[model samples]
Target: MFMDLDALSDIIVLKHVGHGLTVVTAGVDRIELAHPLTEICDLEYSGMVTYAAGGSSVEISCKVARARDEGEPSRPEDLLLTCIFTMVALDPVTRKPVAIPRLVCETPDEEYLFQAGAARSLERRTERKTSLLEVAPDDEESALIHRIWLQQLKYRDRSHPLRQPPNVLAMSRTQLATAAIMQPQYRNRHQTMIFGGYHLKQTFELAFCCAASFAHARPTFVSADPCAFRSPVPVGSVLYLTATVVYTDPAVVEDDEAQDKINKDGGDSESPALTRVHVRVDSKVREMEHGTARVTGQFHYTFTVPKDVRVLPNTYEEYMKYMDARRRVRAGAKSHRSLPVAGRDGPNLTE
Candidate 1:
């Protein structure tokens, strides 16, 4: 059985810097982190620990690692900050506390880099070397796709109805990335992006499962921007959620003529072939009084798949057939939109 958005939303909380809180684990058990810190390493050096209420224990750890400069200080340097949090939820009812599932959060640390003057010295050196390379112009199309995907990951759940009274919580982007990878099709990718609260992760996982089941194709996990918290999810609220593939397209291929043109332009083999996908997520509070039902936020995501995996003639052709069938179904729905209302009050319309 699938969990409703309301039932799942009750146990999860979203915090700033992509941290999530789960209020209940193993059904009817309250869990929380006692100490929250900005940097994971602080937890270790500072001797901090996370605790759970109602006779349960949770352990979390964090660390920061710097990425080496790709070329010179003048070019962009990607730094990785890894946060690892492990939770062992003990069943309050059982008193045995067999290890509940473990949760881990990892991210390429963005917080400290954003701090003023932290990277100023490196930034100055990068400016010089950046001008010397056959400086490739920015690819706006790729950038746009990335931006949209990140925004969808970060801001889609600002108005979650389950978040009534906010609470202190810690969440990590790694968890979201893990959930995305859990989708059948996306398992092969080495990288992924995760955002939002624990409930949000559950919603994404649910949608991913549905999409995988419906399409019978595994998705390719990619990147997520960042999640920002707008409100807090309270404990013991029933959460409901729905996810769907809003748009998908077969991978594109380049003919010999196109390849020749690229060769003439001196482009490298690293040129990217693009495939796109969009996912929509809707969340709400369930198990509430009548008239209190509400929709949280919706997210639209676009994924870019490389041409090698997506554009092979066989793969492209196969995906095209699937897309065609999907389009027909959508068209059939559109045809129904203009029909006359059947009920006395007329079919309720959403505009």
Candidate 2:
């Protein structure tokens, strides 16, 4: 008995006792158990044969790095050995395909954990030290690449089960001078351009630039956010990006004069302009079995604007107030003192 591709693909999800484990129990699709049962039994036997031959079972173990769990927020979680299934050739005696169930193990490896922790630590250090502007020149090619990525971020929907369509949310930019006013690190003569393109994960780096330019400040181009996709985007989709200052912070008003100096020096401030933009993205089912089973995806992001462009005053003020309140709350919490309780004797209690 031979199984067709669709029949072979029909895998059953089964629960295992005592391990909180789920296994792909093969042969559930068969109306008559004899053939499928034999296939499954043979699969287990094959595992035993492989173990005898190589001193280890021919089992592929994949750690579940992220999975949907009930009653938990939609966020990535640590890896766990929660699922186990064994695959082997069809029974040699019967010549039919089958899958076997293997006991899911909870053996945690300390070495793997330490290695993963070290890798994460290094990544954090890199993110803190890496300056996006330092890696690429602020040339036309760089801007073009940034523009392409911005567009991709705005338009391309990576086919994720949980995501949303792309839409225009916000946009802005920050220059070296403006950035210098906020942080002392950028005060040197070198110019740094910041371009942000946001879709979902809008907080992550969509694209950024810090570079020298030779053009005067001018509105060379502008466009609204693109349309949203009706379907989910596949993973590894090329994201296009382009950012322009939609608004700027008022604190860097003085830097406008510095921009003027660059203009007077015959250097064009137009080419290597800094920009930040917020984009929307739509999420849809890339693959589905039933018509009603769908995943809920989200699209929300914030872009960093330069400190010169005139933004909606009310919005900017609200943001500032929110930041101020948050700071105050944090500071007050740090300074808070606990009151001493008096015991029955009218004296402070001591441990």
Candidate 3:
């Protein structure tokens, strides 16, 4: 669905979402429900379909991207939406849930979200602050998204589920990408201003490419740091984007006994170990009139990778970037280690 980011931002500013609660709609389509027998998400949702099951939910997190470049990426000066979706299964008879027999979700993805949610609350309550370029993985936005997902998941049943391993960190690999985009085609659509999503989209694409190429694997889109669009790119401005992989390392640390046990079971030793890649992106818009450049926006991204992958930093710049990424990751981890909010802002809303 087409989401209005400007509208969402206004809501966030107003906190019209019932006391700091934000529910942004994403352009996410439901693929299909997990089959009751095999629990496979193999079907795509086409219109005019019938659900033989009970009520279910697909939770998605969406943010507005600027759509000024109507050439390749069409837009009517609109908010381009990016999304992360989660699906839960429901039963047809009792209108309950069909519990999928799986291990406990110790996946770094889930753990990070749950723990980071608390960590963020602690940071906000403590001394930590944030910027567009650097964000703790477990920030308020992450917490909000994760909380929605966790709430949706609670509808299902879990009994004696085993635990899955967290993602690994990719510290040895370093990646970089730079690109320049032409000005908007639909000048009338924007009238006299540039859309923020256009620049944001360029930076995000570069970051994604850098991460995906560096890993030599598909990088799942996780979370991105906030982009305020504080500065604007002028009309006829050529936006230049620089994307790089700053930090990476394993996320999980198991005890010696647990490690040995997993090793014996052919876990990380056999299966590729997962890692987290932190990608930072910055954009500078070239002003046509003054021939000067101004920083328009910056963003940070988190993606999963295999632990065996090493992103080595050869240059001093790369090394510093790596250190910076590590610092952010550590900060995020710290937030996850704090006392989580029972619900939004600390009070238990359910009561």
Candidate 4:
């Protein structure tokens, strides 16, 4: 997904750089790993501006394909990953959103993609109006919260660890974090900024670890929810990433034998049960002069494990994260249904 952003950043720079506007990643619409590579191989990254709207935001579609070792021509069959991103122009001094170049579709196919992107953009806006962050929890979520409280009450024997339910765990126990000092080697071509891809790679690795530790099994990548870059991190800054298993969807395992098989197989074994894990990674940068840290990026990743597990919130803050993650999961499923399927030419528009 960061590769896509890196490629798409060129378009933003070429179009808006001279206008004295600062461009930043507004959000990631979707990212899907269509196929996973089994061996280390070269990759070709390509991207395009799919839709530019309202003279403020633009949507970019990007893909990663396997690079032939013999320098042979690439094919659609080599496609490995696809992603969609949103970028917005901001006033350099005011840091407020500013107008951007309007998109002009030159061909029928371009117009088709434009319309599709516009629809998706609108859908995202609608979803945000009712997101868990904006409103109180619904009846279903309230019931789940109540159930978690009851479970905690029943298993409050902290001194006797074994007395607690084996399948249930506190959200605090699933937290994992790492920090790094941004260096010149990871700087962007301009020599003043750090590459977004570098941050992405580090964040994903920690998120994977958090999911694995929580599930006690290896996890398969599912999808990433919309992540926004709040600010840009300059070179020589300290970057910190924290990953937490905020929520989970427990799988209905048939028996203990099946559960044991899943744990032994690292969650890759073929089984009817699959638990969905939602992990949130928050990226922050330390301000040396101010002796404080500020959030620079926020990412939400989803993965699947083959075992039954539960993440119970132990505080009000954790409860909010859990509910928001649940909402993101539902929104992601809706996006999957609405997206066009990949075909010979590209995403099948006819569908």
Give the per-residue Cα lDDT of candidate 2 at 230.
20
TM-score sort, best first: 4, 3, 1, 2
Q: Give the top-scoring candidate (TM-score).
A: 4
Cα TM-score of candidate 4 = 0.80
For each candidate in the order shown, give its overall lDDT on alpha carbons: 0.30, 0.24, 0.43, 0.72
Q: Put down candidate 4 lDDT per residue, 1-351, tens digits, no spaces.
A: 575456455564456435466666666766777777777888766666778876778777776677776868656567777777777777867878877777788877778778888888787788779876688889987876776665466557576432344565788999999988888888754566676667777888899999999988899998777677777778888898999998886521224454345345533435545788999999999856777898988899999987767677879789889889887787667656333324234443210
Ranking by lDDT: 4, 3, 1, 2
Worst 10 residues of 4 by lDDT: 342-351
User: Over the stretch 112-227, how does candidate 3's per-residue lDDT look in tens digits?
Assistant: 44344344335444533553335544454444334423432432336523332222223343446464545565221324445433454566678778888777788766455433
TM-scores for candidates 1 onward, in order: 0.29, 0.18, 0.47, 0.80
Candidate 1 versus truth, CA RMSD in Å, comes to: 23.4
Displacement of the residue 37 alpha carbon in candidate 2, Å = 46
Task: Estimate candidate 4's alpha-carbon lDDT, on a 0 to 1 scale.
Answer: 0.72
Point out where model 2 deviates above 4 Å. 1-276, 282-297, 301-351
Encode model 1's per-residue lDDT on 1-351: one tens digit a residue: 012221222222122112222323221111111122234331111111122222333322222222234554321111222211223332335534443232222222222222211233243356436422324323642353344334334333677422211110111100121111122222111122112335445655665564453334464433221122222233334445555444444312123454233334322246644434434455564333443644544433333434312211123322333233233334333532211111111221111
> Taking the tens digit of each residue's C-alpha lDDT, what string does model 2 give over 1-351?
112111122122111111222221121100111111211211211001011012111222111222235675422222211111222223434534334443332234323322333443354356335323234333543443344344335334666332211111222222211101112231211112111111222211221221111112222211111122222222223223332222222211124463344324322335433432322222333222334422322222223333123321123333332233222233323633111112111112111
lDDT pick, better of 2 and 4: 4
- Candidate 1: regions farther than 4 A off: 1-112, 115-196, 225-231, 249-274, 299-351
* Top-scoring candidate (lDDT): 4
